[model samples]
Target: MSNIIARFHKIQVQDGVKVWYREAGAAGNPTILLLHGFPTSSNMFRNLIPLLAEHFHIIAPDLPGFGFTETPENYTFSFDSLCESIGYLLDTLRIEKFAIYIFDYGSPVGFRLALKFPSRITGIVTQNGNAYEEGLDDRFWGPLKKYWKSYQSDPVFVQSLIPYLQDPANVIRQYHDGVADIESVDPAAYTLDIALIQRSGQADIQLRLFFDYQNNIKLYPAFQRFLRDSKIPVLVAWGANDTIFSVAGAEAYRKDVDDLKVVYYDTGHFALETHVVAIAEEIISMLAENQGY
Candidate 1:
């Protein structure tokens, strides 16, 4: 498995931001673009990508400010900017149509790419990526919501959250949030996140994305509209116990897409960490059953 995973590389997008990506699979096969969520990177997909590579081309790029992507000193960390950089990378690769695998923060960035090129998205796989208002539960998003409302005038909110995310206990909780066997989860998951966050100004950028998340919420209707109208192949596989993006958010995609294939995993926020085998199978199956799959 280690030998199969493509070595990571960096590319400068239109904005001059260096995007680090893990690309694998056959060049002629259907392409799968894996977009990561907050506090993690494409490394999270290390286990799943190779399994799918035998069937399709896979590209998992670290969004600017996270993972190996070099966080520019003054780069804008908004979702729009993140999408723009990815969009540029796609163009540079000459990729016109591909399937998008979105999770958490990847939802907004991937959804934006879908909107930008509605016809280009052959399909979409949403793994705990929420686009409906119902997905906004109280437990995890509550405090972040407060931070969003107050960060403009209250520096205290940002001051508190930055360290809270860096704290070892809280960071570990993110990895074990919905896992049934917390002990089985690797320590590397949280430790890797911590090492990256401590990189000079990484914490500040993470907080920026946490605040900008509200803007993604504002675009929920548009994202839903894209889903409803495009009606492309959409698979919703969610971690049932995730407190951050709840199971309700996972089911809400049905309002716009009636034929959506929704599956609930007995896990938490980072479902892939524990359910990679099942999740990979679902994605591979969906791509085959649906058109352009």
Candidate 2:
């Protein structure tokens, strides 16, 4: 497929957030809203967007506190707020109906949007985006779980975790871990992420979002209900070796979504780093099969 050039734009949302997004392809085609995960922004779609753009209009937005997107200091950095900003962006773009590609942090934001605007979401593409309890890997989440348990009573503990969470090494590990060939992973992706996270006040914003993640776990049931009830076509193109969200999470969708298609890649958390072409092909096939969605 011919590469389509992505254009960058920024729009101030209703909540005073300036959302930075990349757009490509013809507006008349089917739309794909790409919501990226933690530590990474719309830049994650840099490779995949062009491939998908051949068939669909692509909108990849950097969530607040992440990329070039500017968020007011007063703006609450929770998943709900993120969804609100994204929803407002969609409204501003006049996107009434579109498919959502959810990853990591994007899962909660996308799921919340699905819950609020059930009729608007045409389908879902989850890439390491967990909505199942079984998907949480205790090995990685153990400390976070402990922090969540003591969130109300222990300010000291939460403050102490700042170092580990904000460590550049950990950010690098997110892309390197679980992949067999480290050379295949691009340093630019994680390097850009590290630079962004090192910015003033960005760590605090990320920590705040981490604290708010407990609520996302609590809402899993509701997300599942929407999946079960809506019967929306879902494509689970996940990284099977991802230690953050296990393969079981990908399988769990079968229980809720009737029109589910699961494709597992051999890479790690950031599957697109190594498998963008295959993932894009899978997305095209899924869209072709569920054109009515």
Candidate 3:
């Protein structure tokens, strides 16, 4: 059993936002930056960290508006700004060369980081992190696309989504949906998410960020170009059953990356919740083969 205990911290980044992050394993070991997705924070990696800490030094941060991270009310909550905050954190920590574990909203942020610092990235582990237009599931994105197009002009329409955003059941569904064994999911995950979403001004942050997600879609080609040009060793261990980001997203990596391994789990969006061990093993094997760590 791994003896490494995860440590929690809050650091003020260059932008003045206090970033809350989880760190584990030895500092000298190979680093893995774990970026999480929508409605969830680094907490999603809580179970996965201990499993991989023995082999990797883990850095999982709560994005500006999520989890324990403190974001000023006036802070701009776009994917670009999110990446900038994370970049500052890395620069402050002097983390030059490291792998990225991207998922959901993290996908865009991580890809942007890769584009900015191509040489600094050692490898990428994308779990339901997408970069292709076709990878987006029409059913899940249909309503979101409408919001993206109209949010600027339609005040009433934008306000209409608030009720759905405030619904605890919707948050619960994000954890329960597409999972064969619902009992496998820990309730504390969504429970904490629900509490955080209810925080003052948090709903607005999430809503604005949701709209800003359109920008991520616009950068899909750039992200793809980075993969094709960099050809960094990529491990695509995705949840085949994820409705938010379909299996096509997982397969899309094969076209651009020359060194890629795709492993599909029969789970949902948060695959780590169910298949943490297998994913950790795959990550270790991939890093060993590529980075000799």
Can you write out model 2's per-residue Cα lDDT over 138-216, one digit (the tens) per residue? Answer: 8788889998888789989988888877798999899988899999999999999988888899868988898899999
**What residue runs in model 2 are displaced by over 4 Å at the alpha carbon?**
none
RMSD of each: 1.6, 1.2, 1.0
Per-model TM-score on C-alpha atoms: 0.96, 0.97, 0.98
User: Candidate 3: which pairs clash?
Assistant: none
* Residue-wise C-alpha lDDT for candidate 1, range 56-127, written one tens digit per residue: 889999988889887567788899999999999999888888999999999999999999999999888999
lDDT of each: 0.87, 0.91, 0.90
Question: TM-score of the candidate numbered 3?
Answer: 0.98
TM-score, predicted candidate 1 vs. hidden true structure:
0.96
Model 1 ranges with Cα > 4 A deviation? 1-3
Which tens-of-lDDT digit does each residue in 257-288 have in candidate 3? 99999999989998999999999989999996
Q: What alpha-carbon RMSD in Å does predicted model 1 have with respect to the real structure? A: 1.6
Could you tell me which residue pairs clash in candidate 2?
none
- Candidate 1, position 137, lDDT: 77
Provide the global lDDT of candidate 3 against the true structure.
0.90
The C-alpha stretches of model 3 lying farther than 4 A from their native spots are none
